[model samples]
Target: MRIAVTGSSGLIGSALVRSLLRDRHEVVRLVRRPSRAEDEVEWDPKRQYVDAAGLAGCDAVVHLAGAGVGDHRWTEAYKKEIRDSRVLGTAAVAEAVASLGTPPRVLLCGSAIGYYGDTGERAIDESAPPGDGFLADVCQEWEAAAAPAVEAGIRTVHARTGLVVSQKGGAWGRLFPVFKLGLGGRLGSGRQYWSFISLADQVAALRHILVTEELTGPVNLTAPEPVTNREVTAVMGKVLHRPTLMTVPPPALRVALGEFAQDALSSQRVIPRKLLDSGFAFEHPTVEDAVRAALRP
Candidate 1:
Protein backbone atom coordinates (compact mmCIF):
# COMPACT_ATOMS: atom_id res chain seq x y z
CA MET A 1 0.00 0.00 0.00
CA ARG A 2 1.12 3.56 -0.66
CA ILE A 3 0.81 5.41 2.67
CA ALA A 4 1.36 9.09 3.39
CA VAL A 5 2.71 9.78 6.84
CA THR A 6 3.33 13.01 8.75
CA GLY A 7 5.75 13.44 11.66
CA SER A 8 7.92 10.71 10.11
CA SER A 9 10.89 11.78 12.26
CA GLY A 10 9.10 11.38 15.57
CA LEU A 11 9.66 8.37 17.83
CA ILE A 12 6.47 6.45 16.97
CA GLY A 13 6.30 7.79 13.42
CA SER A 14 9.85 6.75 12.63
CA ALA A 15 9.24 3.32 14.07
CA LEU A 16 6.04 2.92 12.08
CA VAL A 17 7.79 3.98 8.88
CA ARG A 18 10.51 1.40 9.44
CA SER A 19 7.94 -1.25 10.18
CA LEU A 20 6.03 -0.48 6.98
CA LEU A 21 9.21 -0.47 4.90
CA ARG A 22 10.25 -3.80 6.33
CA ASP A 23 6.97 -5.21 5.07
CA ARG A 24 7.68 -3.69 1.61
CA HIS A 25 5.03 -0.99 1.76
CA GLU A 26 5.62 2.35 -0.01
CA VAL A 27 5.70 5.33 2.36
CA VAL A 28 5.38 8.99 1.41
CA ARG A 29 6.65 11.22 4.18
CA LEU A 30 4.97 14.60 4.58
CA VAL A 31 7.54 17.23 5.48
CA ARG A 32 7.67 20.95 6.24
CA ARG A 33 10.89 21.30 4.25
CA PRO A 34 11.51 21.04 0.51
CA SER A 35 10.73 17.70 -1.11
CA ARG A 36 14.29 16.53 -1.69
CA ALA A 37 13.28 12.88 -2.05
CA GLU A 38 10.85 11.26 -4.46
CA ASP A 39 8.87 9.77 -1.57
CA GLU A 40 8.52 13.15 0.18
CA VAL A 41 5.59 15.58 0.11
CA GLU A 42 5.97 19.18 1.24
CA TRP A 43 3.28 20.61 3.50
CA ASP A 44 2.92 23.73 5.64
CA PRO A 45 0.33 23.21 8.39
CA LYS A 46 0.77 26.65 9.93
CA ARG A 47 -0.08 28.23 6.55
CA GLN A 48 -2.93 25.74 6.12
CA TYR A 49 -1.34 24.43 2.95
CA VAL A 50 -0.83 20.88 1.69
CA ASP A 51 -0.02 19.48 -1.74
CA ALA A 52 -3.30 17.70 -2.33
CA ALA A 53 -2.14 16.49 -5.74
CA GLY A 54 0.93 14.91 -4.18
CA LEU A 55 -1.33 12.83 -1.97
CA ALA A 56 -3.78 11.93 -4.76
CA GLY A 57 -3.08 8.20 -5.21
CA CYS A 58 -2.17 7.22 -1.67
CA ASP A 59 -4.04 4.25 -0.22
CA ALA A 60 -3.93 5.61 3.35
CA VAL A 61 -2.63 8.56 5.36
CA VAL A 62 -1.49 8.57 8.97
CA HIS A 63 -1.51 12.11 10.37
CA LEU A 64 0.86 12.22 13.37
CA ALA A 65 2.36 15.72 13.18
CA GLY A 66 2.11 17.57 16.46
CA ALA A 67 4.19 19.53 18.98
CA GLY A 68 5.76 17.47 21.77
CA VAL A 69 3.45 17.73 24.76
CA GLY A 70 5.93 16.67 27.46
CA ASP A 71 8.95 18.21 25.71
CA HIS A 72 8.57 21.52 27.54
CA ARG A 73 7.03 22.93 30.67
CA TRP A 74 3.39 23.94 30.25
CA THR A 75 3.83 27.64 29.64
CA GLU A 76 0.80 29.39 28.13
CA ALA A 77 2.58 29.88 24.81
CA TYR A 78 3.82 26.28 24.69
CA LYS A 79 0.33 25.06 25.54
CA LYS A 80 -1.05 26.98 22.57
CA GLU A 81 1.71 25.58 20.41
CA ILE A 82 0.75 22.05 21.47
CA ARG A 83 -2.91 22.61 20.59
CA ASP A 84 -2.28 24.45 17.30
CA SER A 85 0.26 21.94 16.09
CA ARG A 86 -2.18 19.02 16.40
CA VAL A 87 -5.43 20.80 15.46
CA LEU A 88 -4.00 22.73 12.50
CA GLY A 89 -1.88 19.89 11.22
CA THR A 90 -4.72 17.39 11.46
CA ALA A 91 -7.10 19.79 9.71
CA ALA A 92 -4.60 20.25 6.92
CA VAL A 93 -4.15 16.50 6.41
CA ALA A 94 -7.86 15.79 6.62
CA GLU A 95 -8.75 18.58 4.21
CA ALA A 96 -6.02 17.59 1.81
CA VAL A 97 -7.13 13.97 1.79
CA ALA A 98 -10.73 15.03 1.37
CA SER A 99 -9.84 17.08 -1.72
CA LEU A 100 -8.17 14.18 -3.47
CA GLY A 101 -10.17 12.79 -6.43
CA THR A 102 -9.67 9.25 -5.13
CA PRO A 103 -9.30 9.74 -1.43
CA PRO A 104 -7.55 7.18 0.77
CA ARG A 105 -9.65 4.44 2.28
CA VAL A 106 -8.37 5.06 5.79
CA LEU A 107 -7.08 8.03 7.80
CA LEU A 108 -5.45 7.03 11.10
CA CYS A 109 -5.15 10.27 13.00
CA GLY A 110 -3.05 10.51 16.17
CA SER A 111 -4.77 10.98 19.51
CA ALA A 112 -4.02 10.44 23.22
CA ILE A 113 -5.46 8.64 26.20
CA GLY A 114 -5.37 12.03 27.89
CA TYR A 115 -8.92 12.44 26.56
CA TYR A 116 -10.01 10.37 29.56
CA GLY A 117 -8.29 12.73 32.03
CA ASP A 118 -7.35 11.02 35.30
CA THR A 119 -9.12 7.67 35.17
CA GLY A 120 -8.07 6.93 38.73
CA GLU A 121 -8.71 3.25 39.51
CA ARG A 122 -11.56 2.94 37.06
CA ALA A 123 -10.83 1.48 33.65
CA ILE A 124 -12.25 3.30 30.65
CA ASP A 125 -12.66 2.46 26.98
CA GLU A 126 -13.53 4.34 23.79
CA SER A 127 -17.19 4.32 24.90
CA ALA A 128 -16.37 6.73 27.75
CA PRO A 129 -17.08 10.41 27.21
CA PRO A 130 -14.41 13.09 27.14
CA GLY A 131 -12.95 14.13 30.50
CA ASP A 132 -11.88 17.56 31.78
CA GLY A 133 -8.27 18.81 31.67
CA PHE A 134 -5.92 20.75 29.42
CA LEU A 135 -4.70 17.67 27.54
CA ALA A 136 -8.18 16.23 27.43
CA ASP A 137 -9.50 19.38 25.76
CA VAL A 138 -6.61 19.31 23.30
CA CYS A 139 -7.33 15.65 22.48
CA GLN A 140 -11.03 16.39 21.90
CA GLU A 141 -10.24 19.06 19.34
CA TRP A 142 -7.43 17.01 17.93
CA GLU A 143 -9.77 14.11 17.14
CA ALA A 144 -12.51 16.44 15.88
CA ALA A 145 -10.09 18.06 13.43
CA ALA A 146 -10.47 15.01 11.20
CA ALA A 147 -14.14 15.76 10.52
CA PRO A 148 -13.49 16.54 6.87
CA ALA A 149 -12.25 13.02 6.19
CA VAL A 150 -14.97 11.46 8.31
CA GLU A 151 -17.61 13.53 6.59
CA ALA A 152 -16.10 12.64 3.21
CA GLY A 153 -16.88 8.95 3.92
CA ILE A 154 -13.34 7.95 4.81
CA ARG A 155 -12.68 5.33 7.49
CA THR A 156 -11.14 7.55 10.14
CA VAL A 157 -9.66 6.09 13.30
CA HIS A 158 -8.50 8.24 16.20
CA ALA A 159 -5.45 6.37 17.63
CA ARG A 160 -5.70 7.26 21.32
CA THR A 161 -2.16 6.22 22.30
CA GLY A 162 -0.86 5.67 25.81
CA LEU A 163 2.54 6.03 27.48
CA VAL A 164 4.91 4.35 25.03
CA VAL A 165 7.62 2.23 26.64
CA SER A 166 10.76 2.68 24.59
CA GLN A 167 14.33 3.63 25.36
CA LYS A 168 14.51 5.74 22.22
CA GLY A 169 12.32 8.69 23.32
CA GLY A 170 9.34 10.05 25.21
CA ALA A 171 8.90 9.48 28.96
CA TRP A 172 10.95 6.30 28.97
CA GLY A 173 14.02 8.09 27.60
CA ARG A 174 14.07 10.43 30.59
CA LEU A 175 13.29 7.59 32.99
CA PHE A 176 16.22 5.44 31.82
CA PRO A 177 18.96 7.82 32.94
CA VAL A 178 17.37 8.67 36.26
CA PHE A 179 16.55 5.05 37.06
CA LYS A 180 19.98 3.83 35.99
CA LEU A 181 21.49 6.31 38.43
CA GLY A 182 19.08 5.08 41.14
CA LEU A 183 17.33 8.45 41.21
CA GLY A 184 14.09 7.21 39.68
CA GLY A 185 11.00 6.82 41.81
CA ARG A 186 7.22 7.03 41.74
CA LEU A 187 5.57 10.44 41.42
CA GLY A 188 2.74 11.70 43.64
CA SER A 189 1.06 8.87 45.54
CA GLY A 190 2.27 6.20 43.08
CA ARG A 191 -1.21 4.70 42.98
CA GLN A 192 -2.24 6.24 39.68
CA TYR A 193 -2.71 3.64 36.95
CA TRP A 194 -0.48 4.06 33.89
CA SER A 195 -1.61 2.61 30.58
CA PHE A 196 1.47 1.83 28.51
CA ILE A 197 2.43 -0.06 25.33
CA SER A 198 5.79 -1.17 23.98
CA LEU A 199 7.11 0.50 20.83
CA ALA A 200 6.73 -2.78 18.95
CA ASP A 201 3.06 -3.15 19.85
CA GLN A 202 2.36 0.51 19.11
CA VAL A 203 3.49 0.07 15.52
CA ALA A 204 1.80 -3.27 15.13
CA ALA A 205 -1.55 -1.99 16.34
CA LEU A 206 -1.28 0.96 13.96
CA ARG A 207 -0.66 -1.41 11.04
CA HIS A 208 -3.62 -3.45 12.17
CA ILE A 209 -5.84 -0.36 12.08
CA LEU A 210 -4.67 0.55 8.57
CA VAL A 211 -6.15 -2.67 7.18
CA THR A 212 -9.01 -3.39 9.59
CA GLU A 213 -11.95 -1.78 7.79
CA GLU A 214 -14.33 -2.26 10.67
CA LEU A 215 -12.14 -0.48 13.25
CA THR A 216 -13.10 3.18 13.05
CA GLY A 217 -13.64 6.01 15.50
CA PRO A 218 -11.62 6.29 18.72
CA VAL A 219 -9.33 3.23 19.14
CA ASN A 220 -7.11 3.19 22.21
CA LEU A 221 -3.56 2.06 21.31
CA THR A 222 -2.73 0.73 24.73
CA ALA A 223 -2.03 -2.67 26.33
CA PRO A 224 -4.72 -4.95 27.68
CA GLU A 225 -3.33 -4.77 31.23
CA PRO A 226 -2.81 -1.34 32.70
CA VAL A 227 -0.47 -1.05 35.70
CA THR A 228 -0.12 1.56 38.38
CA ASN A 229 2.79 4.00 38.62
CA ARG A 230 4.05 2.04 41.62
CA GLU A 231 3.99 -1.15 39.55
CA VAL A 232 5.88 0.57 36.73
CA THR A 233 8.54 1.88 39.13
CA ALA A 234 8.96 -1.56 40.63
CA VAL A 235 9.29 -3.14 37.18
CA MET A 236 11.84 -0.55 36.12
CA GLY A 237 13.92 -1.16 39.21
CA LYS A 238 13.67 -4.88 38.73
CA VAL A 239 14.77 -4.64 35.13
CA LEU A 240 17.66 -2.30 35.91
CA HIS A 241 18.60 -4.19 39.07
CA ARG A 242 18.33 -0.98 41.11
CA PRO A 243 16.39 0.25 44.13
CA THR A 244 13.02 2.01 43.74
CA LEU A 245 12.51 3.43 47.18
CA MET A 246 12.44 7.16 46.39
CA THR A 247 9.19 9.06 46.00
CA VAL A 248 8.42 12.50 44.58
CA PRO A 249 5.68 14.18 46.50
CA PRO A 250 2.83 15.84 44.62
CA PRO A 251 3.80 19.30 45.98
CA ALA A 252 7.43 18.95 44.85
CA LEU A 253 6.37 17.82 41.36
CA ARG A 254 4.01 20.78 41.14
CA VAL A 255 6.81 23.18 42.06
CA ALA A 256 9.23 21.58 39.61
CA LEU A 257 6.99 20.90 36.58
CA GLY A 258 4.31 23.56 37.06
CA GLU A 259 1.12 22.74 35.17
CA PHE A 260 2.76 19.75 33.46
CA ALA A 261 3.02 18.16 36.88
CA GLN A 262 -0.69 17.47 36.86
CA ASP A 263 -0.27 15.31 33.76
CA ALA A 264 2.73 13.48 35.15
CA LEU A 265 0.78 12.68 38.28
CA SER A 266 -2.49 11.90 36.50
CA SER A 267 -3.78 8.35 36.41
CA GLN A 268 -5.21 7.07 33.13
CA ARG A 269 -6.23 3.39 33.12
CA VAL A 270 -6.87 3.27 29.39
CA ILE A 271 -7.76 -0.07 27.75
CA PRO A 272 -7.38 -1.07 24.09
CA ARG A 273 -10.78 -2.66 23.77
CA LYS A 274 -11.31 -1.88 20.10
CA LEU A 275 -7.86 -3.04 19.06
CA LEU A 276 -8.12 -6.29 20.97
CA ASP A 277 -11.65 -6.84 19.75
CA SER A 278 -10.32 -6.39 16.24
CA GLY A 279 -7.89 -9.30 16.97
CA PHE A 280 -4.74 -7.21 17.48
CA ALA A 281 -2.27 -8.99 19.75
CA PHE A 282 0.39 -7.19 21.81
CA GLU A 283 4.10 -8.03 21.74
CA HIS A 284 4.50 -6.86 25.31
CA PRO A 285 1.29 -6.75 27.35
CA THR A 286 2.80 -6.53 30.83
CA VAL A 287 4.92 -3.85 32.49
CA GLU A 288 7.79 -6.34 33.01
CA ASP A 289 7.74 -7.33 29.33
CA ALA A 290 7.45 -3.70 28.21
CA VAL A 291 10.44 -2.63 30.33
CA ARG A 292 12.47 -5.58 29.10
CA ALA A 293 11.56 -4.91 25.47
CA ALA A 294 12.56 -1.25 25.83
CA LEU A 295 16.00 -2.24 27.12
CA ARG A 296 16.46 -4.93 24.51
CA PRO A 297 19.20 -4.45 21.92
Candidate 2:
Protein backbone atom coordinates (compact mmCIF):
# COMPACT_ATOMS: atom_id res chain seq x y z
CA MET A 1 0.00 0.00 0.00
CA ARG A 2 1.15 3.52 -0.82
CA ILE A 3 0.84 5.80 2.24
CA ALA A 4 1.10 9.60 1.96
CA VAL A 5 2.02 11.14 5.31
CA THR A 6 1.81 14.83 6.16
CA GLY A 7 3.88 16.39 8.91
CA SER A 8 6.41 13.66 8.20
CA SER A 9 9.03 15.57 10.17
CA GLY A 10 7.00 15.78 13.39
CA LEU A 11 7.26 13.50 16.42
CA ILE A 12 4.34 11.20 15.60
CA GLY A 13 4.78 11.65 11.88
CA SER A 14 8.46 10.65 11.94
CA ALA A 15 7.64 7.53 13.93
CA LEU A 16 4.76 6.66 11.60
CA VAL A 17 6.99 7.06 8.56
CA ARG A 18 9.55 4.67 10.01
CA SER A 19 6.84 2.16 10.86
CA LEU A 20 5.33 2.28 7.39
CA LEU A 21 8.73 1.86 5.79
CA ARG A 22 9.37 -1.17 7.97
CA ASP A 23 6.17 -2.64 6.60
CA ARG A 24 7.58 -2.03 3.06
CA HIS A 25 4.78 0.32 2.02
CA GLU A 26 5.53 3.00 -0.57
CA VAL A 27 5.44 6.28 1.41
CA VAL A 28 4.90 9.79 0.10
CA ARG A 29 5.20 12.87 2.25
CA LEU A 30 2.83 15.83 2.19
CA VAL A 31 5.23 18.68 2.74
CA ARG A 32 4.65 22.40 3.23
CA ARG A 33 7.41 23.23 0.78
CA PRO A 34 7.42 21.19 -2.41
CA SER A 35 10.35 20.51 -4.71
CA ARG A 36 11.27 17.93 -7.33
CA ALA A 37 12.01 15.12 -4.94
CA GLU A 38 11.12 11.45 -4.71
CA ASP A 39 7.68 10.72 -3.20
CA GLU A 40 7.10 14.28 -1.96
CA VAL A 41 4.01 16.39 -2.61
CA GLU A 42 4.22 20.10 -1.90
CA TRP A 43 1.04 21.77 -0.68
CA ASP A 44 0.75 25.13 1.02
CA PRO A 45 -1.62 24.85 3.96
CA LYS A 46 -1.47 28.58 4.61
CA ARG A 47 -2.83 29.27 1.10
CA GLN A 48 -5.16 26.23 1.24
CA TYR A 49 -3.98 24.92 -2.13
CA VAL A 50 -2.83 21.39 -2.86
CA ASP A 51 -2.03 20.22 -6.38
CA ALA A 52 -4.35 17.38 -7.18
CA ALA A 53 -1.84 15.88 -9.56
CA GLY A 54 0.70 15.57 -6.78
CA LEU A 55 -1.47 12.93 -5.13
CA ALA A 56 -2.80 11.11 -8.17
CA GLY A 57 -2.16 7.54 -7.07
CA CYS A 58 -2.45 7.61 -3.30
CA ASP A 59 -3.85 4.55 -1.56
CA ALA A 60 -4.11 6.19 1.87
CA VAL A 61 -3.33 9.60 3.40
CA VAL A 62 -2.47 10.14 7.06
CA HIS A 63 -2.77 13.83 8.01
CA LEU A 64 -0.67 14.80 11.06
CA ALA A 65 0.25 18.37 10.18
CA GLY A 66 -0.62 20.93 12.88
CA ALA A 67 0.74 23.52 15.30
CA GLY A 68 1.45 22.22 18.78
CA VAL A 69 -1.36 23.25 21.13
CA GLY A 70 0.97 23.65 24.11
CA ASP A 71 4.04 24.72 22.15
CA HIS A 72 3.38 28.47 22.28
CA ARG A 73 2.06 31.07 24.63
CA TRP A 74 -1.59 31.95 23.94
CA THR A 75 -0.94 35.24 22.19
CA GLU A 76 -3.60 36.37 19.70
CA ALA A 77 -1.38 35.49 16.75
CA TYR A 78 -0.32 32.19 18.29
CA LYS A 79 -3.97 31.22 18.87
CA LYS A 80 -4.82 31.91 15.25
CA GLU A 81 -1.77 29.95 14.11
CA ILE A 82 -2.80 26.97 16.22
CA ARG A 83 -6.34 26.98 14.84
CA ASP A 84 -5.33 27.67 11.25
CA SER A 85 -2.53 25.13 11.06
CA ARG A 86 -4.83 22.20 11.79
CA VAL A 87 -7.94 23.48 10.00
CA LEU A 88 -6.18 24.71 6.86
CA GLY A 89 -3.69 21.84 6.61
CA THR A 90 -6.47 19.31 6.97
CA ALA A 91 -8.65 21.13 4.45
CA ALA A 92 -5.89 21.23 1.85
CA VAL A 93 -5.01 17.55 2.28
CA ALA A 94 -8.67 16.56 2.21
CA GLU A 95 -9.19 18.50 -1.00
CA ALA A 96 -6.09 17.09 -2.68
CA VAL A 97 -6.81 13.54 -1.60
CA ALA A 98 -10.46 13.85 -2.64
CA SER A 99 -9.31 14.88 -6.11
CA LEU A 100 -7.12 11.85 -6.60
CA GLY A 101 -7.94 9.59 -9.55
CA THR A 102 -7.73 6.70 -7.12
CA PRO A 103 -8.41 8.20 -3.77
CA PRO A 104 -6.87 6.53 -0.77
CA ARG A 105 -8.96 3.86 0.92
CA VAL A 106 -8.57 5.60 4.27
CA LEU A 107 -7.92 9.19 5.36
CA LEU A 108 -6.45 8.96 8.86
CA CYS A 109 -6.99 12.43 10.32
CA GLY A 110 -5.35 13.71 13.51
CA SER A 111 -7.29 15.02 16.49
CA ALA A 112 -6.76 15.14 20.25
CA ILE A 113 -8.62 14.05 23.35
CA GLY A 114 -8.94 17.76 23.98
CA TYR A 115 -11.98 17.40 21.74
CA TYR A 116 -13.84 16.25 24.83
CA GLY A 117 -12.67 19.36 26.58
CA ASP A 118 -11.84 19.18 30.31
CA THR A 119 -14.00 16.38 31.59
CA GLY A 120 -12.82 16.48 35.16
CA GLU A 121 -13.17 13.00 36.70
CA ARG A 122 -15.84 11.87 34.24
CA ALA A 123 -14.99 8.93 32.03
CA ILE A 124 -15.38 10.03 28.42
CA ASP A 125 -15.37 7.91 25.30
CA GLU A 126 -15.97 8.33 21.57
CA SER A 127 -19.69 8.55 22.36
CA ALA A 128 -19.17 11.62 24.51
CA PRO A 129 -19.94 15.04 23.03
CA PRO A 130 -17.19 17.54 22.29
CA GLY A 131 -16.03 20.07 24.88
CA ASP A 132 -15.63 23.81 24.41
CA GLY A 133 -12.35 25.69 24.69
CA PHE A 134 -9.30 26.71 22.64
CA LEU A 135 -8.00 23.21 21.93
CA ALA A 136 -11.46 21.70 21.64
CA ASP A 137 -12.58 24.26 19.09
CA VAL A 138 -9.41 23.72 17.10
CA CYS A 139 -9.86 19.94 17.11
CA GLN A 140 -13.55 20.19 16.18
CA GLU A 141 -12.81 22.30 13.14
CA TRP A 142 -9.75 20.24 12.30
CA GLU A 143 -11.86 17.09 12.12
CA ALA A 144 -14.75 18.84 10.40
CA ALA A 145 -12.51 20.21 7.64
CA ALA A 146 -12.15 16.71 6.28
CA ALA A 147 -15.87 16.33 5.59
CA PRO A 148 -15.28 16.64 1.89
CA ALA A 149 -13.15 13.53 1.77
CA VAL A 150 -15.72 11.60 3.75
CA GLU A 151 -18.49 12.85 1.54
CA ALA A 152 -16.50 11.81 -1.51
CA GLY A 153 -16.63 8.13 -0.47
CA ILE A 154 -13.29 7.95 1.34
CA ARG A 155 -13.06 6.41 4.79
CA THR A 156 -12.01 9.10 7.29
CA VAL A 157 -10.77 8.21 10.77
CA HIS A 158 -9.99 10.76 13.46
CA ALA A 159 -7.37 9.61 15.97
CA ARG A 160 -8.23 11.64 19.07
CA THR A 161 -4.98 11.18 20.95
CA GLY A 162 -4.24 11.81 24.61
CA LEU A 163 -0.86 12.66 26.15
CA VAL A 164 1.62 10.62 24.10
CA VAL A 165 4.50 9.68 26.44
CA SER A 166 7.80 9.40 24.60
CA GLN A 167 11.44 9.83 25.58
CA LYS A 168 12.64 11.90 22.66
CA GLY A 169 9.90 14.49 22.13
CA GLY A 170 6.99 16.33 23.68
CA ALA A 171 6.51 16.42 27.45
CA TRP A 172 8.73 13.50 28.50
CA GLY A 173 11.83 14.92 26.87
CA ARG A 174 11.21 18.31 28.47
CA LEU A 175 10.84 16.75 31.93
CA PHE A 176 13.63 14.12 31.91
CA PRO A 177 16.39 16.51 32.95
CA VAL A 178 14.25 17.92 35.74
CA PHE A 179 13.48 14.40 36.93
CA LYS A 180 17.15 13.51 36.80
CA LEU A 181 17.88 16.54 38.99
CA GLY A 182 15.22 15.42 41.49
CA LEU A 183 13.20 18.53 40.65
CA GLY A 184 10.21 16.83 39.09
CA GLY A 185 6.90 17.20 40.90
CA ARG A 186 3.11 17.15 40.44
CA LEU A 187 1.11 20.05 39.07
CA GLY A 188 -1.59 21.96 40.98
CA SER A 189 -4.38 19.77 42.38
CA GLY A 190 -2.63 16.62 41.31
CA ARG A 191 -5.96 14.82 41.58
CA GLN A 192 -6.87 15.92 38.05
CA TYR A 193 -7.34 12.97 35.70
CA TRP A 194 -4.71 12.46 33.00
CA SER A 195 -5.23 10.30 29.97
CA PHE A 196 -1.97 9.07 28.43
CA ILE A 197 -0.51 6.37 26.18
CA SER A 198 2.96 5.16 25.25
CA LEU A 199 4.58 6.29 22.00
CA ALA A 200 4.81 2.69 20.81
CA ASP A 201 1.08 2.27 21.52
CA GLN A 202 0.36 5.37 19.49
CA VAL A 203 2.08 3.87 16.45
CA ALA A 204 0.29 0.58 16.99
CA ALA A 205 -3.09 2.31 17.23
CA LEU A 206 -2.47 4.14 13.97
CA ARG A 207 -1.65 0.92 12.19
CA HIS A 208 -4.70 -0.73 13.70
CA ILE A 209 -6.97 2.01 12.41
CA LEU A 210 -5.41 1.84 8.96
CA VAL A 211 -6.09 -1.89 8.74
CA THR A 212 -9.53 -1.99 10.42
CA GLU A 213 -12.17 -1.33 7.77
CA GLU A 214 -14.97 -0.99 10.30
CA LEU A 215 -13.27 1.71 12.33
CA THR A 216 -13.92 5.37 11.46
CA GLY A 217 -14.71 8.73 13.04
CA PRO A 218 -13.46 9.83 16.45
CA VAL A 219 -11.33 7.14 18.15
CA ASN A 220 -9.82 7.98 21.53
CA LEU A 221 -6.14 6.97 21.52
CA THR A 222 -5.86 6.71 25.30
CA ALA A 223 -5.07 3.88 27.69
CA PRO A 224 -7.77 1.81 29.35
CA GLU A 225 -7.10 3.16 32.84
CA PRO A 226 -6.78 6.93 33.13
CA VAL A 227 -4.56 7.90 36.08
CA THR A 228 -4.61 11.06 38.13
CA ASN A 229 -1.83 13.64 37.97
CA ARG A 230 -0.66 12.61 41.44
CA GLU A 231 -0.61 8.98 40.38
CA VAL A 232 1.46 9.92 37.35
CA THR A 233 3.98 11.78 39.53
CA ALA A 234 4.14 8.88 41.97
CA VAL A 235 4.67 6.35 39.18
CA MET A 236 7.32 8.47 37.47
CA GLY A 237 9.09 9.04 40.78
CA LYS A 238 8.94 5.34 41.50
CA VAL A 239 10.21 4.29 38.07
CA LEU A 240 12.97 6.91 38.00
CA HIS A 241 13.59 6.39 41.72
CA ARG A 242 13.20 10.10 42.45
CA PRO A 243 11.21 11.79 45.19
CA THR A 244 8.50 14.24 44.10
CA LEU A 245 8.11 16.36 47.20
CA MET A 246 7.44 19.70 45.56
CA THR A 247 4.38 20.95 43.75
CA VAL A 248 3.75 23.45 40.96
CA PRO A 249 1.05 25.75 42.19
CA PRO A 250 -1.76 26.86 39.90
CA PRO A 251 -0.69 30.48 40.13
CA ALA A 252 2.78 29.57 38.94
CA LEU A 253 1.30 27.54 36.10
CA ARG A 254 -0.87 30.51 35.04
CA VAL A 255 2.21 32.74 35.17
CA ALA A 256 4.44 30.41 33.20
CA LEU A 257 2.03 28.97 30.59
CA GLY A 258 -0.64 31.64 30.26
CA GLU A 259 -4.02 30.13 29.30
CA PHE A 260 -2.51 26.74 28.56
CA ALA A 261 -2.22 26.38 32.32
CA GLN A 262 -5.78 25.07 32.12
CA ASP A 263 -4.48 22.41 29.76
CA ALA A 264 -1.94 21.17 32.27
CA LEU A 265 -4.27 21.43 35.26
CA SER A 266 -7.44 20.24 33.58
CA SER A 267 -8.69 16.66 33.44
CA GLN A 268 -9.94 14.30 30.72
CA ARG A 269 -10.58 10.61 31.47
CA VAL A 270 -10.71 9.41 27.87
CA ILE A 271 -10.99 5.70 27.11
CA PRO A 272 -9.95 3.67 24.06
CA ARG A 273 -13.41 2.20 23.42
CA LYS A 274 -13.31 2.26 19.63
CA LEU A 275 -9.80 0.90 19.46
CA LEU A 276 -10.45 -2.05 21.75
CA ASP A 277 -13.83 -2.76 20.20
CA SER A 278 -12.03 -2.82 16.87
CA GLY A 279 -9.68 -5.50 18.26
CA PHE A 280 -6.66 -3.21 18.86
CA ALA A 281 -4.40 -4.37 21.70
CA PHE A 282 -2.13 -2.03 23.68
CA GLU A 283 1.54 -2.91 24.34
CA HIS A 284 1.90 -0.75 27.47
CA PRO A 285 -1.39 -0.48 29.33
CA THR A 286 -0.13 1.65 32.22
CA VAL A 287 1.93 4.81 32.60
CA GLU A 288 4.62 3.17 34.73
CA ASP A 289 5.23 0.43 32.18
CA ALA A 290 5.23 2.95 29.36
CA VAL A 291 7.72 5.15 31.22
CA ARG A 292 10.02 2.21 31.93
CA ALA A 293 10.02 1.32 28.23
CA ALA A 294 10.56 4.95 27.23
CA LEU A 295 13.38 5.41 29.76
CA ARG A 296 15.15 2.29 28.43
CA PRO A 297 17.34 4.11 25.85
Candidate 1 lDDT tens digits, 1-297: 999999999999999999999999999999998899889999998987898888988999998889998899899999999999999999999999998889999999999999999878998999999999999999999999999999999999999999999988988888999999998899878999999999999999999999999999999999999999999999999999999889999999989889999999988998899998989889898989988998989
State the C-alpha lDDT per candidate.
0.93, 0.88
List, residue by residue over 27-88, the lDDT tens digit for candidate 2: 98877676578888888899998876877777788999888877878999999999999999
Give candidate 1's error at residue 200 in angstroms: 0.2
Winner by TM-score: 1
lDDT of 1: 0.93
